[model samples]
Target: LRELKTKIACTIGPSSGDRGTISELINAGCRIFRINFSHGNLELWKEWTDNLRQVSSSLGVDCVLIADLRGRSIRFASPIDAKTYSAGQTFYIVRHDGREGEVPSVDSPEFFEAVSENDVLVSDDGRGLMRVLKRETDKIMVQALSKLTVRRGKSLVIRNKEIPIPNYLSHCVDQILDAVRLGTDYLGLSFVTSPRDILAVREFLDKNGSDIGLIAKIETISAVANVEEIAKVSDAVLVARGDLGMHFPLEEVPRLQERIVGTVTAIGKPVIVATQLLGSMISESVPSRSEIVDVMNCVVDGVDVLMLTGETAIGSYPVETVNWLRRIIETYEGDVRTRREISQDQLVDRFALGVVELAEALNAKIGIYTKRGNTARRISRFKPRTQVFAASNDPKTICRLMMLWGVEPIHVDSKEYDRGLEELEQKLKEQNLVKRGDTLILTYGLLDKPIHTIRIVQLIS
Candidate 1:
């Protein structure tokens, strides 16, 4: 299989959680596996993580695990029979307090307190819309604006409204420690409204002495409004278009996606564009023409990663879904140009840009020796056109580098930078990844230092 610059992330579920299926997925070019906490227990998550690790080791591929925490997103408290509502029909949204009532309800008291009369509630990505008519002590009466069905555990959001993040996120500490115990490299924070949400989690992680990176999900209007601040605090940002459609008009989703992508990329952080990239392929064997175009557009937009949610989690053709996505990414990746120039006043940022400019001018591939992956990330922010290889001795750093654009992570055992680069070059040569007469721009530096060294080397027969 050919290496792809734009990485693919697959959500693990019953359809693709087995060792054999995971091996197939790794061979099919999935480097990041997402374990969603909303659906599975710790036992199941451990099983999935074990299978992924074993399969990846057997296949000699390094993969990263993401613990997708179920943040403050509101959902039905319990299973309820699906009920269809007609336009202008009255429905009661009751708080789940063991009360016997034939109404859709949520278990969160904050949600009930935050909602008011005339507020609009949407579910299933705006498929169902309800306007709040009146508020009682424990329930709210709403009028249906469209004909739709209400199902159990369906996510509902107050349209265009931002709910406050509680002083403490319920169960977040336990979830963070659970993820650390499971050896996850990144935490995917859902429904993030501002930088404070990320900082609060970061503070908790630091207190516990965990260095797991954070990827803030930009799905709320408030999140989009404060994206710059959020991106500054986050290690990465995710453009969650599915729930974003619920918080904003459908027509504005595409524009919002572009804006979020641009903002996150400019901040020198990895940005992911997710949700419904290939929605049709969940059941069908082939992707729709529009879906293919959408994938290509993401590549053109300079997105670091394109993620698959339902397309791989519950979809019948998980392996083929990854195969098609890989093909789409590889097909358009060569034509991608840097969308914009990111200007930074830091010496490291200017040095990275100069290295990229030199590599481009000489038509040479770039190689870096990094201990904490900061140099690799700085170079990645420039959107280098040539192939870039980042070698590190730290396993965590290598896994985290998998999320960056155009970066191929290599793991070496050497503690010294010089030896690490030698090992990296040998591996590249043994794998035929680089050939004789190919040019390489080798570079490395200390993150704390104001100076870096660059070298031009040509492979010899």
Candidate 2:
């Protein structure tokens, strides 16, 4: 399989959870796996994580596992039988005991108090919306704006209120702790509203002595307002276009995505463009023209990762979705040849860019030796024409580098300069990443050392 600068992250679920199917996904160029903590139990997640690790090890590939935390889902308690509603129907949402025809009490008491008449409540994954016509002490009378099949646990989004969700919801705290114990490479916090939310997760991880990367999902207006502050503290930020669209106008989502990507890129952190990149592929064998255009636009916008949610989780053509996404990214990125330069004021970032420019100008590959993958990320922002071989002994660093653009991470053993370089060169040659007589611009730095070195190397038989 050919590698692209923008990585493909597939959601692991019942559709693609088996060993054989996962192997096919990896062979089809899926670089990362997202284990949603919102759906399954801890036992199921651990099983999936262990299986993913074994599969990646056996296949000799890098598949970074991300545990997506379910933070503050605004659903309501339901009776034994859930009722479905149609357009123009009047439904009632009660905070107390609701009858069979009436809507059940919502999870958050704040939701009932914050919403008023004339406000809109979106449900059915944002496809179904309702307008509140009247509000009483215990119930809200709403007019269905669209037909929807309401289920027991479906979350309702109130567009008027800026809902304050907890950093770690009740159900996700145990999952987060489990993720740290299982050595998950990253944790995706859904519905993040501020920098303090990111810090909350960070504090918990720190208290537990875990170093998992925190990815803040930008799905709310508050998150967009505080995106820069959140990006400043987050390891990465995801443009979760699903709920984000519900919060803002659908036409405005693309611009919001671009804005968030640019902001996070400027901060020198990875930006993931997620949710419905290939939504049509969930049922169809191929994606629609607009979906293809959307993927291409995101790549052009300089997103580090393109993610598939339902397209891979419960889709009929999960493997094909990933393959098609990879093909689209490869074709578009090759044709566009765009460069996303870091706008940081640090000398190290400038040095990294200079090295990348040198490599591009000289038509030489960049050989980077980094322990934490920061140097490689800095270089990747430039989008060099030549390949980037990021060599790291740290497994976590190598795994996390899977999300980086234009980087092919290789794991090395020795920290010694000559030994590590020789091993890395051998691996690259064996893998045909570099050929004999190929020139390389090498960058390396010791973990304790404050200095970074950039040099030249030529391979000869």
Clashing pairs in 2: none
Estimate, for each residue in 243-304, the C-alpha lDDT of model 2 and write its tens digit: 88778767888889888888888777889988888888889998899998989988877788
Which tens-of-lDDT digit does each residue in 1-461 have in candidate 1? 77788889999998899998899999889999898887778999999999998999988888989998878788876446778899999979888887544578788887888899999999877778899999987889999999968766578899867767576456476787789999898999988878888999998888889899999999888889999999999998999888998999989999999888888887789999888999898899999999999999999788899999888888999999999999899899888768446456677778889999999999999988999888898898878889999999898889879999999988888888778788888888887878999998888887577668888989996
- Kindly report which residue stretches of model 1 are placed more than 4 angstroms away from their true locations once superposed: 80-89, 98-102, 147-149
Q: Which stretches of candidate 2 lie over 4 Å from their true place?
A: 76-84, 96-105, 165-171, 336-345, 417-419, 446-449
TM-scores for all candidates: the values are 0.95, 0.93
User: TM-score: which candidate is best?
Assistant: 1
